[model samples]
Target: MSLSAPVLAFEENSGLDTAESAASCALKLVRHDALSKADLSAIEQLAHQPAARHSGNVFFAPRAVAASASLSRGSIDWLLWFQDGRLCLAAPVVISRIASFSLVRIWTHTYAPLGTPLADKRLRPDLLFEELADRGFSALACPLLETGSTLATAVALPGGRQDGRAGFWSGIAERAVLTSDWTEAAALSAQRKKKLRKMQRTLPLVHRVLRGDAARDEGFRQFCELEAMGWKGAAGSALKQSDTALAYASELVASHGAQDTLAIDSLEDPQRQGNQSVAMVISFEIAGRGVVWKIGHNTDYDAVSPGYQVILAASRRFAAENTPIWIDSLAGPEHPLVGWLWPQRLTVGTLVVPLKGSHAPARTLSGFYQAEARLRQVARALRQRLRR
Candidate 1:
């Protein structure tokens, strides 16, 4: 069947107003390809709201949403809850199912991390979740949800939970962020600072802060090349390894650059042939906060610790221009360099909310899946331990 333009549909008792009126409000499900001009405008407006200020900008805009869907080879459906003609809650989901159990998952990717749903202050998440339960979704998988987030207070799956149940297969989204203090030389240990200084003096290192669409695009292309020359290339996981992934990178950078939120910083070795870049870090500024989204480094410069030098310099520069908001690294928890650099932790895990009046079979299926997730976690833990 051909996809139609974005259509707004009403559902009973879905409003965020009084309990009665809220139930009668409409919940709009707009497919990514079907978003209309009006829908985009509302989403943009909703993105700028104070409540959404902390949610990363990538998942809020039309271009970012479309790019993620295309790059990840997944379809996105935005579940919208509106009150008084204004958007109260906006959740972008990629639907999946297990036999009878349908799930609405917050779209995520290895390259791009997504935050929680964008919901205004007036909207109650628990009530909205219940409403979704009525819509035939057996469960909700909110990955990349920060720990202690009140927005997604529902029960969690087999991954990390507040109750201290640690699953072996749990993945943590520990966004590496730098505080304003990191920009200061005093923030570094005496040995680290001295090493950085020595590297700067001995190496013909050139740092360039690339801005605007053209420069950002150029940097992205260079980044792909740089990453492909490293371990990721051999591992077949670099952006250039897949056309779709590359397109997604291009789209995301272009979108963020157009909004003036994209920042690409590169550390080049001027003395080297081709003026090769030693390290490059891509970051996005959202609501005065910086998120260090991606980093690529030339393994040839591993001896010089090019990634660390570049990231430190970039952090200092970013801190100077903007009030240093916490810059989330979006790196894995056990990242060697990033973990050492940023001592603070932001926990990320999956949340599973069983739909209202969920049947026993569906709940049973969820339990089975959770068990499998736990086993995977255990295997992962064993691998890490053995590697050590």
Candidate 2:
């Protein structure tokens, strides 16, 4: 924490619609290394707050962000929103230079499914964009924002039709989500469920939701090792393929688990001598929201659908625990298994919002962004098809 860093002050009213004096509040750009303990606490509180619009997530939580920072390719910076001289919203972003343009985007790992700004209930997204623009930024690049979120809806809509929305926006996409209800747990066809049940009876499967350090460590290790031995290994994209990626993931799990917010759900064959795990799922729950982060299964158990069984185990746990919000699938939108099994779905996408404007600049910037976004989507589709 840098006590000597100059405080960057703004003359405008706090972007937060808090009851406090709409008096002047400051916006400070504090580098990760300079974040104070107080700032980190504020972020955690906002993320844990049920009333916060798009801020309720574990990805941007202090320890998670810090762990991600260690493995990130860009420098981490925090943008704080203050109201009545108190921190109201925060966005941790990675600032970089792209083709003579300064790109400020949400600080999220490739696997992070949400880019929600850590914000107060009434915090406005445009306020942050305007602040960035005043600091010479052209726009804010936010990726993986939820489709139905107020801010995301405005960004995805043509022409920023909503009042006080982003000046311009682009790139809308959809992701899968499963409602945390027992009703949603059996969305698969009756025949498929019957097959899974029969496989379970034959395998004598033991479902475990590991939360303790020792147990979770072992289970997560099993998961990473399993993933590495499968297709991800062939693709050279498994966590164990990169020392740093694996270490960072371990740290992230440990950090979140310390708060009782992480779990490793697994299915093991109790009939086997060593009780070997056949499948595993890494999940994080903060307050009411749950995220199904990763899944891995032993190919040897494909006939039993170990992967699906473990997923079902996780879903049942979430429902029994009464998880308030839906669980993000984190799997691709086109993912066959989870997408077919989980009836509910949500959209998420990468988008850039032109800073503080309504007319010519917004139109030109948004049009260019939409065109680029289409190209990127086409490239991604081609890659997927090629891989298939």
Candidate 3:
């Protein structure tokens, strides 16, 4: 499918009013084989709203969809629901052939994150599943639902017909949430604090949040390069190494930057005037919350623990913000780096709904898949035990 041009315009508005409008307005669903210009614009607008969650403007953006779809052998469907001329729910569905049946996912493999159809808490999500299946989707999978997300309830069918199953696939969608009283020093031990203090005194490092276009662009590019410098680069998974990734990152900065959603925090080394950045973090503000999406640092500065320093500075900055928002370390539960610092683990799960309804065959297939997944998990645990 041919993708339309990228649209990055989004304006913040009152959530209550939007929800009310969505509840009362007439709903209509429009499906396109390829992403249409109007749908792209509407999707971005929905993504920027307070109702959206995790990787809101980044993964569901037009550029992201195009990139992910380009690399996958699947069909793309840009589905949008218009309520009284306003875009209410935008669901980008990817359909891939799996054996004799087709598998449906809210997202393609191009993007790491996925999003469900945007809807108010009052809406019944079963309607969503029925509509998609009526339109030819074999099954609908929501792979990125937060533990307490409204989608979990919104998509539920009446009469206990919500036959979908949700499971916590560790390392799938984890986050670190910090309270108002969170402190950088609290995350580090006394010995580590002393060492960090010494590093800070030696170089007199400065942490700044870059806001200007040139500065933000440079910071983002530097972050990509820094990520490419380490294991990600060696493993050929770095964003800087892929043209599609470069474009997606560029669009994220442009779109979110315009709305003041994108934030680039950098730890600078004055001694290295030519290369001031020792560590950097790329984060975005959503619904008054901060989501730290990426972090990178120069390995050469490991002696000073520049990576930890940068994270500390960013966390402190979030704490000091007048808005009183919590910072979410998007790193998963098993992340060795951020796990030690942020003790809290956000619960996330995936909801799978069979479009064909809960038939005997569908039930059997679901049971088989669940058994297979459990076997894999058990085998993985046994391997870890053996290693120990």
Candidate 4:
């Protein structure tokens, strides 16, 4: 598919009755390198909207994503969604293969856990699907979507319900997200609580949040160094493991810092020889919302559970604020530590949206989803058994 033209146009449904119906929508296909300065500005504004910000996704931000695409060495193709005669959403997608099926899907990488697109408002997925179907697409495979989010609701499968497009009540289950009111899961054991209490008192801590260029840079260095001192480094998965990963992280920090959305919070051990940081967390603020992006700890301080401590402390502070706010852990539901401490969860899932008039492919993919879920469950069981 050549990237030079608009694929489809539709009547934008702006609420005002007097609004001109001539305001039309076009799903423009643009490559990353082809994006103009004006286009970047528009996308930066789009990142401020709920679909991106509420999910704590900085990846959809213009500068941040450009950095990502450059380093990931992948094709960066974007479908710019225009609704109400205005740019409503922007997301990179690929018509690629999955189990012998060539499907249109939200482009994703290992580092990007959530595949939610950057949308200014709720978009009608049904309309988008019909348009794609008309354009020869079979289905849209959306993975890692927050089940209750704007993009998810727009694309969730309709079960012939009363409200056919109610995504708040639909979608397949994929993962769990930790939200503000996160204390909803079953309580931890008394013994476990007592152990954690003991761990907290083990280190006399000075919790600090670093901003500004100099301090934030130093904090980032500390984080990478600490992470490299542990299993992540040995496993070749730490930020310092590869120059490309390091550059990507650096670019993200710089981009978010310029937007006043980046912060490095750490818990320093005052009693340590030189007041070393025991745990560090790199986080991004999306307006009032927050995302805990990366965390690292001094394995020597494992007895104190420094990583979890800093995160919980941050969560407590968030909850203590007068204004209501939510933060995403950015960890998968299978993550042991995050789910245990933060009990409230956001149901995330993959949706297979069958393009209009092309029902077979979507049906096949739906069956594939079921089988994949079963396999994943079995894999988890095997892991548990191995651990035991």
Q: Kindly give the number of clashing pairs for every candidate.
A: 16, 0, 3, 1
For each of the candidates, the C-alpha root-mean-square deviation to the true structure, in angstroms, is 7.7, 6.9, 8.4, 6.4
The per-model lDDT (C-alpha) reads: 0.66, 0.68, 0.60, 0.64
Pairs that collide in candidate 3 are: 68-110, 125-154, 125-155
Candidate 4: pairs in clash: 182-344
Most lDDT-accurate candidate: 2
Off by over 4 Å in 3: 1-41, 53-58, 82-86, 99-102, 108-111, 114-117, 156-174, 179-181, 322-327, 359-388
How does each model score on TM-score? 0.81, 0.83, 0.75, 0.79
Q: How big is the RMSD of model 1?
A: 7.7
The Cα error of candidate 3 at residue 186, in Å, is: 4.1
lDDT of 4 by residue, 91-168 (tens): 877666555455677766656666777776556544555556667666676666665666655443344333222111
Q: Residue 114 error for model 3, in Å?
A: 4.3
Model 2 residue runs over 4 Å out of place are: 1-22, 52-54, 98-101, 153-166, 180-186, 273-275, 356-388
Model 3 lDDT-worst window of ten? 1-10
Ranking by lDDT: 2, 1, 4, 3
